[model samples]
Target: MNDTTPDSLIPYDEIVQEALRAVVGRVLGQVEDAGGVLPGAHHFYITFKTGAPGVSVPPELRARFPDEMTIVLQNKFWDLAVREEDFTVSLSFNQMPSKLVIPFSAITAFVDPAVDFGLQFQAVEEDEDDLASAENDSANGASERDVASRITSSEDGSNVVSVDFGKKK
Candidate 1:
C-alpha cells in the first residue's frame, strides 16, 4: 500500500462518497416505487445544500434556508419521484404545498431516526464566483436565502453507521 501513489487513480474517498449517495437514491426510489409508505418506524432527515447544482426549490424557501436545509420525510410528503441523478418530492410548508428537486450530489446527511442510523458527507465546494452569481439570480434567489437561514451541524461524522470496513486485519 505504501508504494501506491496518491495521484494514480480516483481516490477512495470520492468512490465511497459516490456509493453512499447511491444509497440515498435507492432509498428514495424504493419509497417512490412502493407508493410512499415507509415501513415500520423508518423515517429520514435528509440535509442537503440548497445552492447545489440541479436542486430545485421555491424562492421563499431558498431565501429562508440559504446554505443547507434538513427535511424530514415522515408524516407528510407527496409526489415522490426518483431519478438517476436526483429525486423530487412535494411537501407542505405552512400548509402550502411545495415541491423540491434535490440532486444526490447536494446531499450532506441522511439520517434515519428509527434506528439512529445516519450518514454524513463532506460538503463539496464550487466556484465561488459562480455560486455568488447563482445566489443573485432571480430564479434561485429565494433558495439561496433559505439555504443561508438554516442551521448546519459542525460535525462531519462517519458516512455510514452500520459498517466499519476500515479496520485493518
Candidate 2:
C-alpha cells in the first residue's frame, strides 16, 4: 500500500483563482451600474500589488508603496470604471486626487466590512526571481494576512473565502 499521492496535471488553482476574480469583477460591475453610489453602508477595501503588470498608479504612490497598496472605496471616489479584466477609479490621497487602474490579476484582497464578506487571492509571480523580489520588497501597513486575520476573527456569520494550498516538495 503506497501512501504517496500523485499530483494531478490539471491547473485547478489557476481555474479557481480566475473564477474567484470574476466574482470581484461582477461585484464591481454592479457598483458601476449603480452610478458609483454604494447603497447603504457597503464599502470596499481593495488591496493589490503596486508592481504588477497593467497596474497604473501615480508615480509618487508607486514610489511610496513599492510592493502592495490598499484603497478604500466608500465615499469621495469618482469616475468608477469597471471592465472585464480591470477597473479604474479616482480617489483622493492626502488631499491629492489621483486615478488608479488596477487589473483583477493584481488584486490580492477584497473586503466589504459592511456585510463581512472578503476574498483573498494569491499573488501570481512570473518566476522564482520575481517571487524573491516581491518577498524582499517593503511590507505594506495592511497586508493580505492582516485582512484575512481581521475577517476570520468575526467568523460567526461572515462570508470569507481564503484558500490555502499546500504544495508537496
Candidate 3:
C-alpha cells in the first residue's frame, strides 16, 4: 500500500457544516413554536459574522461590531421567526430596539449555558484579502460577556462541538 493518503473527491466539510447548521435551525424553530418563550433556564448566546451575506443588522450596530458579534436571546427578545435558511429576531441594544436577520451560514458559535451545550462553526470567508483584527468576544451588551467566559472556561470539553477541517497540503 502507498504511504501517502489521497484526498477524497467528496466535499465532506461543506456537507458536515450544512447538517450542523440545521441543528441550530431546528433549535430555533422549537423556540418559535413555543411562542418565543425560552424554556425554564434555557437561553442562547449566538455569535455570527456581522459582514456576512444575507446578514442584516442596524447600520450603527454593524459599525460598532464591523466583524463578529454575539447576541443573547433570553427574557427581552421578541419576534423570533425561524426560516429554512435564516432567522430574524428583535433585540434591544443600549435600550434601542433593533431587528437582526442572520443566515445560519453566518453563525460562528451557538451556546446554551443552561445545559452547557455549544456549537462552533467555521466562518465562511467573503474576502481573503480583507483581514479583520477584531476579536470574537465582542457582543451587543454586558450579558454576552458571561456567555463568552463560560464558553472559554470549559476545561473538560463536555458538550461543545467544534469542527475544524484542515486544508490538504
Clashes of each: 19, 0, 0
- Candidate lDDT values, in order: 0.69, 0.77, 0.81
Superposed by TM-score, candidate 3 places the C-alpha of residue 62 at a distance from the truth, in angstroms, of 0.5
Off by over 4 Å in 1: 1-8, 126-169
Worst 10 residues of 1 by lDDT: 132-141
- Residues 59-86 of candidate 3 have per-residue lDDT tens digits of 9999888878888888899999999999
- Winner of 1 and 3 under lDDT: 3
Every candidate's CA RMSD:
7.8, 4.3, 2.9
- Which of candidates 2 and 3 reaches a greater TM-score? 3
Candidate 2 residues lying further than 4 Å off, grouped into runs, are: 126-157
Q: Which candidate is the best by lDDT?
A: 3
Residue 32 in candidate 3, Cα distance off native in Å = 0.3
Ten residues in sequence with the least summed lDDT for candidate 3:
129-138
The CA lDDT at 49 in model 2 is 84
| TM-score of candidate 2 versus the correct structure, residues matched by position | 0.83
lDDT of 1 at 155: 42
